[model samples]
Each structure stands twice: as structure tokens, then as C-alpha cells.
Target: MNKIFSLLTLLFMLIYLPSQANDFKAVYELAGRHFPWLKGKVDINPLENKKQGDAFTIEVVQNRLKIEATSTSAASRALDWYVKHYAHQSISHMGNQIKNVSKLPLTNGKISQSSFVPYRYALNYCTINYSFSFYTWEDWEKELDWMALNGVNIMLAPVGTEMVWYNTLIKLGYSDQEAKAFIPGPAYTAWWLMGNLEGWGGPISNEMMQQQVTLQKKILARMDELGIEPILQGFYGMVPHDLKKKIADADVIDQGNWVFTEFKRPGIIVPTNKQFENVADVYYDELKKLYGSDIKYFGGEPFHEGGKTAGVDVPKVAQAVQTSMQKHFPNSTWVLQGWQNNPSDKILAGLKKENTLIIELFGENTNNWERRKGYNQTSFIWSNVSNFGEKNGLYGRLQRFIDEVYRAKNSEFGSSLKGVGIIPEGINNNPLAYDLMLDLAWHAEKPNLDKWIEDYTVYRYGKRNPKVVAAWKEFIHTVYNSPVDENGKVLYQEGPSESVFCARPSLKVNPVSSWGTRKRFYDIERFKKAVAVFISASKDFKGSETFETDKVDFLRQVMSDKADLAYSNMVKAIEGKDQETIKSSSSRFIQMLKDQDELLQSNSYFTLNRWLNQATQFGKGLPDAKLAMYNAKAQITFWGPDNNPKTTLRDYAHKEWGGLLSSLYLDRWNLFVERALAGQTVPPAEFYQMEVEWSKKADLYKPAKSNKKNLARIQQDILK
Candidate 1:
């Protein structure tokens, strides 16, 4: 009996303990790095059945805490649970919600928890550029820790794809300079990977590419330590648009213009062509040499966003792409974005169903998963693109997220539902949106909103003040509310309500970005009431970073709403020929913008200086610091191909940051006011020129020197 038990223990260690992929000791070291007090006070033990799926337990034995978890990811989550439920402290993308304690709190008993799913995924390809474009190793260190604590085991880390492409292009008979031309700048890699446009933001310096490659190495090392599997950008027949100009042998299809006629999309090499597999082989070989051969997932979207597929044999091409991927990384899963008709019926018909995973993108507004019958029984993650262009506004389909997730989990195709994920185009805003969605992976049934949100508030704001808690409850039904149809699908909303303040000033301004909603969907009065209550509790959380950051965020929303009202009144006055009303309202509107800029200074995260500074800082050792700066400015303003004024994507990534609000956005609105008062048509050409000029300016555009008011005073002023 003793011999049999010992053999069973040895088998269990070999089967379930991830001592090779990631060690339990590393999780202890990670905890030590984060909280110094936890260095000698905790022990992390590995479980014996991780194949049964991820789970964790917390207990205290003779004062020292113990965490028994199936994997490093689960252990990290267990620590996070202890911190939130017992210690009453938590960390988030925004900031830490912490308070001084006499001693570390322990669980009441052996509290155990388990996840129903095997994957907890995070990030969209665009998130790499939108939120982390300028991130140094220091920034990624924190970001990875946050991800691990949140139980995200699968992440998209397609940074440094330029290096892989550069080498592949060079091997395929291109000069060094020519190869570099194919790679985009740091700010434009997302679209380049999606094959939308190539070389638009480019020719990133060779030194910068190497730095990013090294950065990715470090990123991967940390992810491995924390049990995160990275999804890399796979080669799916996309080559540089100009590649056909040089390589006349291969048949390359012209994808024509992307969003605008100015930027040409990359050409696709049909799988039937001899060079298709040849290019893919070189691409993957270069990828393996640089990044390592342990990768198990690849992300590539063919025919994404209206790319031409006329001549391509859709099914054959799909099969060829997957075959090449499998040849490179055996047993790997192909991660496809189920957006619109992508991974279409033709594409799905050719693949090995068991090895494919579709991220059901646009879950906030679309039901492509159910409509297509669980993506035709292929495994998929129920996901949401909560924000677009990293824009700021409070929005989330709170209840509908729960409803839709469970609705799918209980459906006939439930076995195909593998997990949950957040694929926001930009992930810089709305922590609750990401946190709540990710949290659902651990539960088997619908979470009690009242209980979950109350706990969320506690961890989100250290010790939650009653006023703040009450305000959040109201917030649930207001800005965070999702009006669903009888089938549990939300009414169409493309991300949050676009701020009227960010829009290029016009009497007919609907949304700041193209393809965004023209109407505000929630009750303005209820939202204001919540904000006021949130502010009332500020006195208790005076020095808290989380509280202060939220203060800036909440107040920004109020000012944006106020700006809309001011703009509307001015537009009415101008039409009625009420000269006095027009002058007063216009002047007040400009003043409101000035006040908004000042209010944004309360949080550095909400400031333009931080973004621009990161850009210039990233370019410190590079040949030209100005190029990075130009990319940063261009992304937010003109979003350029330099000379194109008719580009529809202007102000698509418009930020409501401090320095930017006062400068470029202010100047645009000021011009509109001047034109409105004079009854002159505000020339769109003139505004585009201003945007062009702003993008070209060498100045860093730091915040103005002013007597900044307290957040409370700013709130009052915004209300008035």
C-alpha cells in the first residue's frame, strides 16, 4: 500500500505539476518582488491535477499562509484573492488600491476556488500599439504582474514582428534598407500585422527594432515565469504592397486601398502560388530563430476588413495557411478573429476543427457566435472589444456580459465554448470592463451583481466609502447599463459614447470618430448624480491614488457632458441670429475646454505629456527622436499618410488629455467659435491644415503654467 501510494504521488507530480513549464518557486519570487512583507510569510505549493483544469486554495498554517494552485497563473490569482478579500488591498491597470495594515490578514479557512475554463485570455493586436506602444521593460514588468494577478494565462505579444519580417525580406533577396521600409513605426504595427496598410508609419530604426526584440525576449521570460502563453503574429500570405513591384515572379493580388485611398493595403500571395509556402517558411524560420520554438498559438486575419479575395481560392488558401502553421509549430492552435464574415464559411470548412480557436470579437453588439452556431462547432472565446482607439468614456454592457456568457455556456454548442477574453482595440480605459469579463472564467453560474460589484468597489477603492458604494450601484444602471433585446443581445453601440468635446467642432458634429455612435444612450441626469455622490466621498480617500485617478476620470465625463450642452446652446444661438447668446455661449464653451484641460492635470495618466514623453523617451538612443514624436502626434491628430487631408480617420484616436485638450483640441474649437460668431463657414480644409501643422511641430507641448484648482472646485465649476 505504501509503495502504491508513493507511485501515485510520483505520477501526479509528472502529470499535473507544471514544474517544468513554470515552477511554483517562481510565483513565490514574483510575490516577493511585489510585496516585500510577503517574502517570508507565504508558501506556494503545486497541485497534482492541473489537467482537470485550473484551481486554487488559500489557508494559513501556524501563521504562515499557504497557496496550493494548479499552475503559476492560478497561484498568482490566489494571492490576488487574498489581497482583495482579506487584506482589503488590490492592484489594477489604473493604480493600487491599498491601505496600511497592522498585519497581513489570513483566510478564515481553507477557501478553495476553481475555474470552469482552461484559458483566460487578454489583449487585441491593436492594444500593443494603443496602450503599450511606448512601453519600456519597466512598464511591461508592471503590466505582466497585473495580468498574472488577474488570471490571464493567454496574452497577445506580437511586438517586434518587424524584426521577423526584416530578416525574412532580407533572405528573400531584398537589401537592408528595402527590408526596413516594409516594417512600420512603433505606432502603426497593428494595422501592418492585420495587412490593412504597410510602411505607413515606418521604417523604424534598426537599433529600435533590436531593442524591441530584446524587450520581447524579456517579456517572454517573465510571461513564462507567470504561466502566460503568448500569441504571435503568423504569416498568412501578406507581403509588402510594393513587394510585387520587385518580385515579378510571384502572382500577388492588389488589395487596393484600405480605409482611405491614400494608404494601399498589403498584397496577398495565393496558397496555390509556389512562393506562398516559400515566404511562410522563411517567415516562421526567422520567427523561431529569434523568439524561440515553444510558441503554441498564432494570430493572423486573412481578408480582414474588406480586403480583396476575388482571385484567391478561399478554402484551399485557408488549408494551406493552417498546414504551414502546423508544420512550423505542431499541435498549435490557429487563433482567428470572428469579426463580421471573417473566418467565413469557406475558411472554416477547410481547417482541422479541433486545432482552431475563434475569438468572438465585437461581443458587445454582435451575436456572430450563436448566429453561426458556435462558429460551426469550432472552439471559441466569448470576447468583447470594449473600447476603440483607446478613447475615454464610461461604458460597459455590465449585465449583458453575464447574460450572454451564461447563455452561450448553457446552449447546445456549450462544449465548443472554451473560455472568455477581452479583445479591446484599446485597453487603456475602463478597468471594470476588462476585470469583470475576465472574472467570469472562474465562475460556473451567473455572478450576483449586487455582491460582485460591492466586492469590486471594496478592492477598487481600498476601503469603500458608503457614498462611493451607493454611487457605483447607481452607475450600474446608468452609464454602465446595456439595454438588451429579448434575446440578451445589446442594442448596437460601437464602443462608448464619443465625447462631444473631442469632436472637430461643427454644428452637425455627431461623434468624434468615424463609425462611432451619434447618440448618447444613457440618462445624463443619473450619471451626474452618481458622479456627485462619488465626489462626496472623496474626503475619506484623500491620498489614495486609485481614488484620485477615478476623480479625474469621473470629472472628465461631467465636463464632456457639459461641453455637449454648451456646444448645442451655441449652435442654437448662432442659427437664431441671437448675437448676444451666441457670443456668451461660444465664449463659455471655450472657457469650459480650458477648465477641462486643467482638471485633467490631476492624473498624469490622463495627461498628454505622459504619452508624448513616452514616445520621445522611447526614441532617446535612436537616430531621430522626432520620428517617434511625429508618430505619436500623427496617430492622434491627422492619423496620416502625410499629404492626405481627406483621410477619414482624423481624430479617430483623439485623446482628452491635459496638454492636448488645451492645445490642438482647444485651437480647433476656438477656430470654430471665431467662425461661428462671424457667421463664416468653418472651412474643413483649414482645420485639416491645423492638424497637419500640429503633427509636424517639434515642441513636446507640455502643460500650461497655471494655478491648478482642486478636483472638487473643478467639479463645481464644470457643474456651473
Candidate 2:
């Protein structure tokens, strides 16, 4: 009887194991249908090891993969866990753990390459710059795929709020024209949604508004499939500025100034208004119809981004907004951005602590987090808003800031620091900074960055050597750790005010540009030696299209860096009055710019057109009050000297050159033209002649009135 029982048990074990393996295959096939890019590549083999126990491991040979338990039951629980949480089209886990790692090397490309480990439950805050309507299903799918593969499970998706607002406005008897005017253009949605400015570049078409609502539905659906939580924009008493036109008794306050534009700041509607209750009800009802009433959190603010409130009871307004939310959802939480001097004490004073959560956005610099620290009340996430509005630059929370945060989290304040989050305005700029930040979230203790970088390099590049590994380590230590120079004061490049310039010329004065400095600081000679070996090994595999593209990208980075370094040397030589050196350097710099332009133009994968456009706009004509419109245009593409360390002569020109020249030389030029044409027929050629002569005089330096104190004050204002 014992022998028979043992034979029966063996047969049952064989049948059960095979069925379990087949279950993973089924899940993979289902996931592949949606994420077609993962077909045939993702390994779904169950990891059978003494340590793994009953857990099935799925791996991707090319990218990171995440896994988790699907259910509580012991039998088939692990499989359920893997299917529910880990089985996704974009990211998979199987085979050797190392094989499923990222294979893209670090490069100074237009977009940064990043990956998160254990890849299952990470949240990615990729601030989409273009109009949300511009992104089609494919674009959103690809974005979610990238996020999923990199382990991003949380995202800020506020697309359909327009529908909610539209419905509310319609129910309030406002005409479509008035409502459409309140919504902004696609590019300016983030600011509008944040309640900073409204009706600026607006008058959106009904089609466009509907398109965003439809897109949000798709976005939310896909995010749900991949386990990414979407933070919808909540109503926080943000009403149309023109509300007074409809309601004679409406009370509102004007929000100060609109950043980067001359548009009138929008007014905030009083939440206490009887109309407010109706608007909230209609808005959330529409939201529920579209997205289902399963939301746990709503992200919105009163007097947000920069709106204002006059004759408003702060505590009452806060209570009303919270009360309205609960009336609809019962237990919804409000997620607020802990920006500079925002969510003032008065506003947060009367709110229930448990129903609110704050994201300590600038935690890298101001301890508004530690100071308020949940206002001695609620939970918060330690988040860093690294890039401002997807600006192209390298910056992050300082090492000391991270150290302090880590230490604080493990201390008495740990309860308040819920989890670390990446609240970047842009996600595609700095890969290393993000990877490092995310890594800290999972580990119990801090990692030895040097060793971790080595592993990261190997995983990113498929194969890594001693030289390449060494280069990455050097990059992390030198360029990444370089300090920013603020008006001749040296400050680490990891805080809110830190300059965007990645490296300094000699630590004496900050360099004018971030790009060239980083290139110069990197040991190019050593990098080339290692790259040569990589090129040789990759040469034969160049026939493969993907590999070929990767090779081109890698080589382009090398050439671009070399060009930047050459340009820096040229600039230095020019400053030193070394004519021969200047001539050689300028020639090289121009050639490199030309080559880079050509490379970008030729390669369909990436383009530097945006940067080039910015460079051109900055160098265009003189500054005039009329040119304020043009300056604003340039500001859209190029960051000003305010927070950017890389403020250049070009930037200064956009800000002051035109105005300064106009003030000093405009009178003389006009006089010359008027005199030259006095009493006789004036030809356009004569005006041009006068202008040429005036240009020479205008270019000369002149000592202006002593206004140092005023200028310093103006500079401070500019920074704000």
C-alpha cells in the first residue's frame, strides 16, 4: 500500500507541475496580445530553486521585470500573485535574473535611460508637455509599456477633468462658448489644471475637449491593466474668472500674475457660494460616469499654482471642499503639492489630518516638509520635483538631502514620510539621478553607489568591461557630484536653486552652458579607449536593426561630447585672447555643431531641433517691449537665469540686450535717420545706412548709472 501511494504521489506531482508551467505561458500569451512588443521575448519559465520555493519567476532578457503574490491561498497563490500583479506585457521576469536587466548604456542623449528594480510597484510621474489630446492610443500604450517595464505603477493622469468641468458648466446654464474659453490650449493644460492661470491660451474646440476626455478613458483603462494608479485632478473651488458675469452676487479674488505671460491671472470662485455645491455634484457625477466611482484620491488645490481668494474664509473653504469630496466618494483623500509657500497654514489648519496627504515636492532643498512635516497631522510622501515642466537639464536632490531624508525616515519622523516618490516635471532628462532615487526606496539600507553603478552598467549595456564600468563610476563621482556656482558662490548641484550647468570651467566661475562643461569634465580619452573595444565587439552585429540603432546612438553621444569639449576649449581660448587657439577651436566648434545637426537630422530616432530652435530664438533680434511677446516665446523653449546655472550671453541677450541697446542707442539711431532724411526724400537705404553706423556705436560699452542695489533687487525678483 505504501509503494502504491508513493507511485501515485509522483504521478500527481508531475501532472501538477506541468499545469503550473503552462499557466504562466497562458498569462504571457494574454499579456502579449495587449503588449505586442513583448511577444516571443519575455521568458515565463518558473524559477525552480531551493531558495525560490513556490514562487514563479518571469524574466525579460532585455529589461527589468516585477513579480508579486496574486492571492492569499497557498495552493496556486503564487501563480495568482504573479498573474495579477507581475504578469504584464511591457515587463516580464524569467530565466537568469541578470538576463532580465536593462541593456541600454548611459549616454548624453536627448532622453535619459532609467530602470527600477523588482519592477512591479513603482510609480512614474512623466509630465507630458504636448497637449494630452496629441497623444494617441499607441503613444500612451508605449509610454505605459516603458513605465511598466521600468516598474512604474503610479502616475499622474489628469486628462478627463475637462469633461467634468464642462458638464458642471453646462448644468450651471453657461453657454458652451463661455465654458470653452475657460479651458486652456493643450500645451498649457498642466498649469491650467494646477489652478495657476486659466483662459490664457484658450478657446479650445469642442472636438479637442472631447478628444482629451476619450483619451483619458483609454489611458485609465491601460493604467489599470498595468497596475498604475492615476491621480485625477480634484475640484478645489477653481471656477471660471467670468463667473461674476453670470452671477451678480459672485465673490472672487484675482490670482496675482501669470508666469511667463502677460495674461490676466484667473480668479477663484468662493466654495461657499450656493452654486458651488451644484457644480461639485455635477462634476463628480460626470467623473463617476466616465471613470467609475472607485477613486481613492483627488489632486486639486484652492488658490493653486497661483490663483487667489479674497473675502474667503480659509478654514471654511477647506472644509467645504473636503466635505464635497466625501459627499460623493465617502472616504476620498486630497493629494496636494508641497510647493514653495503653498498650502498655507490657514488652509490646512482646520482639515482632518487622516483624509489629506502632501507630497513634499521640494524636499531636496526647503524643509517645508520637515518644518510643516504634515502640519503635525497627516501622512506625506517624500517626493522630489526634479525637472521643472520637463525642462532638459541635469539636476536632483543633493546627496546630503537624500542622506538626511533616509536618516529622518528611519527616525521618529519616519511615520510621516510614507514613501519616496519621483515627482519630476520631466522624466526623460536624467536617468542616473532617477535610478539612484528609486533604488533607495526598496533597499533597507543605502547602497554602495560605486558597486551598484557597476551592476547597473552591465545590465544597461548587455555586456560591460572594466574600462566602461570605471567610466560610469567616474561619471557618478565627478560630473554627478559637481557643484553649481551661484553668483561666484559654490553650491552643490542637487537643490531647488542649483544651476543647471553640470560642470564648471575651473571652479572659479560657473560655465555659461551645462552641455559643454559636462563633456569637458568627463575623461574623454579613457572613454574612447573603452568605446573602441565595445565598437569592435558590436561591429559584426550591426546588421541587426535594433543593435544598429543602439550603436549609432552610442557613437553619436561620443561624437557630441567630443564636439562640446572642443567648443568649451574654443570659448576659453577666445576669452584668453589666443587668436590661433580661438581660430582652431571656433572652426572645430562650428564643425561639431554642424555635424551634430546633421546626425540628429539624419537619425529618425532622436532630434536636437528643439534645442537648436531655442538657441536660434535667443540669438535673434534686439529686445524691445514689443519683443516681449517674442521673449515669452523663447522662454517657452529656453529656461531663464532664474534657476538655471547655465545662463549664457544668449540668455542675457534675450532678457536685457535688446532693451539695453534700445535705451542707449535707439534715440541716436532715430535722430540720425531723421536728420539724414531731413527735408529731402528719404530712401529706405538711407535708414539702413544710419542703422549700420548706430550699430557700431551701440556695440561699444558704456558705464550706466550706479544702480547696483536696484539691479541686485531686480535679480532677486527674476529668481522668484
Instruction: Pick the lDDT winner.
Output: 1
Task: Give the runs in model 1 whose Cα sits over 4 Å from its true position.
Answer: 1-22, 100-102, 485-489, 704-711
Q: TM per model?
A: 0.95, 0.64
Residue-wise C-alpha lDDT for candidate 2, range 109-220, written one tens digit per residue: 1211111121122222226542122355655765665454434445678876777777778777789888877876554566677766565444555655666677788988
- Estimate, for each residue in 1-720, the C-alpha lDDT of model 1 and write its tens digit: 999999999998887675542467667776776766676788888776644999999987776779889889999988888888777777777778766554667677899888888888899888888888888898899889889988999988998888999999999889998888878888999989998888878777889898899999999998998999999988888997777666777778888988868788888888778888889999999999999999999999688989888967888888999999999999898999999888898999989998899999888788889999999999999999988888888888888788889999999988999989899978878888888998999888889886888898888887867898898898889888887667954689888888777788788998678878646677877888888889888778878888888878888887887778888888999898777998898888888888788888667878888888889788888885778888988898888777777788888888888888888888898888787778876777788999989988887767655454554566788655
* Residue 548 lDDT in candidate 2: 37
TM-score of 1: 0.95
Model 1 accuracy (lDDT, Cα): 0.84
* Error at 535, model 2, angstroms: 7.5
Clashes of 1: 0
Candidate 1, position 313, lDDT: 81
Candidate 2 local distance difference test against the native: 0.50
